[model samples]
Target: MTLLAGARVFDPETGETTRADVRLDGERIAEVGPGLDGDQRVDCSGGLLIPGLIDCHVHVAFRRPEPLPRSARILEAVPVLRGLLARGITTVRDAWGADAGFKHALAQGWISGPDLLVSLRQLGPTGGLGDTWDPAAGAVDNYGDPSLPDPLFDGPDAARAAVRRMVRAGADWIKVGASGSMRAVRAGVDVRPTDAELAAVVDEAGRCGRDVLAHAHTSAAVVSAARAGARSIEHGTFLEDDAVAALANAWYVPTLSPMSDTEFAGTHRRSLRLAVEAGVRIAAGSDLAPRPHVDLTTELRLLAAVLGDAAALKAATSEAARLLRLDGDRGRIESGLRADLVLLDGTDLDVTDLPGRVRAVWHDGERAGALTSP
Candidate 1:
């Protein structure tokens, strides 16, 4: 049981904030009102209390390998995991390269990290966006993990089989590369799964009561995925005018970090604003590297620059939960929701410095993350 007193709590659902005290009991929020009484109280007098953030895309078990051995990279991901929580991210949806074993470890207290929603491994065709084939390094999936799924399927039957494989492996979501990688493929963005293949994957996922998220960059790919019933387009960077309408019913997670390269910086920024103005549902995902370059704050900061403060906050919090199909369980500071909270000691609840200003964090009503000051 814990009490966070006198803070500005932002309601992601309403985009309104108010001053109140939040009381937690066991693992759920007990109450949220002005004069809530509790057994243990922490005076967050001038702080900002917000629902714990959710990152819709991350690759926890994969990162650039240098200086550290393969196993060290896995073990050393602890700090980055802690860094995520300290920065107020309490839940993460691992895009790929994470297995069910790792998710169970986070749930069972074997690891100190956020509540993990893992996709196990991304399913894609041969020589596609998720292909781990480096000319120099033969067939290494994200630094020599052969267990990662890169099944090549030419028919709808094969695609359905791949989706079932992931579902049987305890995947929470089925991640598919609907478009090709610019750097990896000679055909560039034109490399995409056929509409039939996308339909098969989506069909299998729907039958299992799981959602499918597509890594789509081009407008054509985005349109195809949305038509095929993917829950969201992971990197809908090049959405056209008509493509924007396609995403009206689907969430668009424009992972701003990776696509900020030379050819995309200005246009990608413009497309983000267009997506918003065109009534497309936008969610936040830092496609940031996991180990050496873990940072969720920059994504929010950049998102705020494009979508203003309140919407930017929603991109990271409640809206992200909706994209991950976790709206009912968490992603709010309500009385009955899971008590995943982040208390900030800062000037205000701004996106840029909100990560650094995290005063304390609570996951499942238990104190977690870095408490900079008592």
Candidate 2:
């Protein structure tokens, strides 16, 4: 048993932030109150304790500019996960790049990492951004290349087959590319899958008892994917007022915070503000690919710049967990949930000052030391 005392516990779900003690038994939180008894006690005086952060979108094997060597990419996964753990991210929904073997390795204790929920490889139509061939440039490559292995499909039948392949490969969820991507190859093409194709992927995933996360950038594509029953929209970078209204009753994850530093910030900021005002369930996702380290606080800081500090924290903790369907098991400083928590050194949740405040991190009731400067 362990006790974390004299800290302000932030529970976003209940809107409670009070000075309290949290007791842990093994990997789960045993109790939370003013004072708790435990065999071991840690002084958390003058600190803030909250649920461990969650990054809803990440690509573990991705490398920027050029793909890394296969062996290097594989070896990097452990340290990447460790970086996330060190930053107080105990759970991550790997949107792409994790294969069945990699996930199994993490699950079997062969790799020390977060609780990984992966959507095998992203599924997309031929000539799509996820596809290997560049139609305009007349360049061609195999879809299964180590550098770009996100499965490509040609039609409804192929989409169904690809989803089944992912399920057979032991995927926890399905990822479908419903629209074009600005960062991937074929940047400006409208790669939205046909409505029938979108339905086929969703149906196939439903048959396998899994939810689908759709990668969408355009307003039309976002609405189509939402209507097709996609569990979440990965980017929603161009969401408009009408599009936001369309997703008012559904879950949408805007991965725009990380891209705020890019050239597209002006256009994306207006769209994001509309989406937030429309009450579309906003969740935090770093879209942290190829960085070797996943930084939720950085993502949160960007979110606070766009939204506010309270909304940014909610997006990372409770809101993101709800979108990932892990709210019950994590995401709150409550009893019976996993004791994955983060202890910041300061009282103010200031976005500009977050880098200096992340003093320590805790994962599954075990303390990990301070975060290194970037």
List per-prediction Cα lDDT, in the order shown: 0.79, 0.77
For candidate 2, give the lDDT: 0.77
The pairs that clash in candidate 2 are none
TM-score of each: 0.92, 0.91
Best by TM-score: 1
| Candidate 2 regions with alpha-carbon error over 4 angstroms | 134-150, 183-188, 290-294, 353-355, 369-374
Q: Report the C-alpha displacement of residue 201, candidate 2, in angstroms.
A: 0.8
Write candidate 2's Cα lDDT for 1-374 as tens digits.
Answer: 99998889887765557889999998899999986888998888988887888888887765334655556656767777766777777888888777666768876878666778888678888767566565575655433444334477888898899888888777888998888676642356576689899899999999999999998888888888888889888777788766787786567777765666777777777777888777778888888773444366667777787788877888888888888888888988889998888887865566565546666777777776554432
Worst 10 residues of 2 by lDDT: 141-150
Model 1 compared with the native: what TM-score? 0.92
